[model samples]
Target: MIGNGTAVEINARKGIFFEVFLVFLKLGLTSFGGPVAHLGYFRSEIVEKRKWLSESNYADIVALCQFLPGPASSQVGIAIGMSRGEWRGALAAWTAFTLPSARALYLFAQAMAAASGGSSGGWLHGLKVAAVAVVALAILGMARTLTPDRIRASVAAMAMVAAFVLPSAWGQIGGIVLGALFGMTFLKGDMPSAAAALPLAISRRVGAVLLFTFFALLLGLPLIAAMLKSRDLALFDTFYRVGALVFGGGHVVLPLLKAEVVPHFVSENDFLTGYGAAEAVPGPLFTFAAYIGSAVGGWKAAVVCTVAIFLSSFLIVLSALPFWNDLRNHPSARAALNGANAAVVGLLLAAFYDPVWSAGITNRTDFALRIAASLLLFCWKTPPWLVVMLCGVAGQVFM
Candidate 1:
């Protein structure tokens, strides 16, 4: 019933913004188990209980955000906030949902920095090993979902090769580009049937402007950072770019982040250590940026990185809201997304080999720990936070 090519009636009301903030903050504090679980929690809280939107409407929002880069759960929260209380609602939702995890990780980073031998500590190594298991599990699950056919499998394989050959952020970006090209050429399919239109408050013009701004910053930030040689600007650019380019949410950002930050902004141990600790937190995995930024330049850097990364998500979800009604029906868009997702699997695989597998498995004990962690993750279907704890204990005692 919300179908249209124009703005929906504003539902803005007094206290609605604060209401949205409170709801999301509650979710932030309790919604653990990664992005997928976060989605389920949202659907229950917003759609089922609160009755914010119909089932089909929520599905459409999720569908749109899932295809775009950045954390899908956070984007969905923003979209709902916008639909309910306009832009202020969107801001409230994002702030509340992200604050818990970001604050937790920032504190963790400070502690690690304060610890004298923290980098070489068994707990940190266990975190690294946890990252190994997590990434390995991510690739397997994603490959099954994203690389189902021979063509997509080949795309993933080629992406892995590209990541290895180039061995940098460019390589990862190239693989995504390559996947889009291959998808357009070979993965073409019939156009999708249209779905219920979202109750978007943004106009196509505003969405277009935001979309352009998103790309402009994406393209211009790096040049500006390089020209001015400003490390802070460069830091913002790196996190923003990673948030913009990641196809699959959550674990897909691992390799791209590792490529950019490892040895430059943060060491490999601190990187994985943060990632593993992120698993234990109760919000978006993108908050991992806060920890890395803290390690690089303290809380101010943490604030910059966190803002820069999530800002992309806000821009993208807002931009796409007005366009999704048409874009989601295009067969080519879907195909390109498929190819990009396949490339993500390949990227994860490459990450597994280098920083994940290579660094985590230094000896027979570590190798055995990897297998046990994998089993706990895959066969046991254990929660990742639990896995992190178990692995940390094992790494402390055995490793």
Candidate 2:
């Protein structure tokens, strides 16, 4: 027979899990705007209504997620869930938030597979053009917010040059590291007091284990796959590393994913097509992994790649959450994050020029279409999916 305390704990855990699932599932289905907007929705629901965390605490978590790699909004959501119910709550939040978008993209991939030849139509081209516009707008928006100061602006410029020159996973990682170092040396300013640190839900020991596991996978996965000589394992390793290392928002993953997938697992056209389709869907852009995986192999690959990408993100968030409060309150950490954020903006700008612009903006007509799409997205403040649909129709008619 269970003791009273044990029974109460079990019941409370179940309640927390279910609450996290329901709340995020709703957001996953309904959250239409990008990461910034998703944060607004999360604040409204979780902070205002549910009262899971205080405003300052939520802001601190957002700061930590922004400073680290992977999807920021998703990480924030996972952190909130963990705050409510530890690792289980974090898993619940991620699954509920990601499932709707992942399922939609996976099913769409199946449809695209069925209509293989049909995917190269004018509408698809329009989608590609729209993607170019979307990424451009993202870069502009992020730059405005992240690199306001001249010092930060310079860091962004340097990072952009490095990424443009190298155009590899290592390039991105190096850019972030350099940004942090620069931040520590040059970007230090009025730092937040350490007294404001939020309490950790998980202990330092657990955080250490999670952080250790993250590095172990990062370093060991490729070697393990090579030893086993498994193509599937290698694919998983590639996607996992990409997911683990990407800074900025979901769009930042574009160049990284393109480098990893195109000419190897999938064609360039197919990769761009999936990216376009991702814009038309709601929820996190990371779900684009599902589409890429499905296009390359089938549902099996889809499942594997999707899990691989998101699992890395999950591990990173879990590892960081337990120690984020202390990190954020430190002056050095704040300075490093300032530089890192600006560097991320630079990385996005480079991506916009390369795979996004070069691949999508082919002719004068494509350029004109992208310009119009940009106006719609930025000037008109149109919804992305709607903009995607209009662009698709415009592509069919014009391009």
**How many residue pairs clash in all the candidates, one count each?**
0, 0
Cα TM-score of candidate 1: 0.94
Report lDDT per candidate.
0.88, 0.84
User: Could you give candidate 2's per-residue lDDT for residues 287-382 as a string of tens digits?
Assistant: 899998887778888888888887777788777876766676778878888888888888888878877788889999999999899999989999
Which candidate achieves the best TM-score against the true structure?
A: 1
lDDT minimum window of 10 residues, candidate 2: 189-198
Worst 10 residues of 1 by lDDT: 3-12
Q: What's the true lDDT of residue 157 in model 2? A: 90
On lDDT, the leading prediction is: 1
Stretches of candidate 2 above 4 Å error?
1-9, 117-119, 193-200
Would you list the clashing residue pairs of candidate 1? none
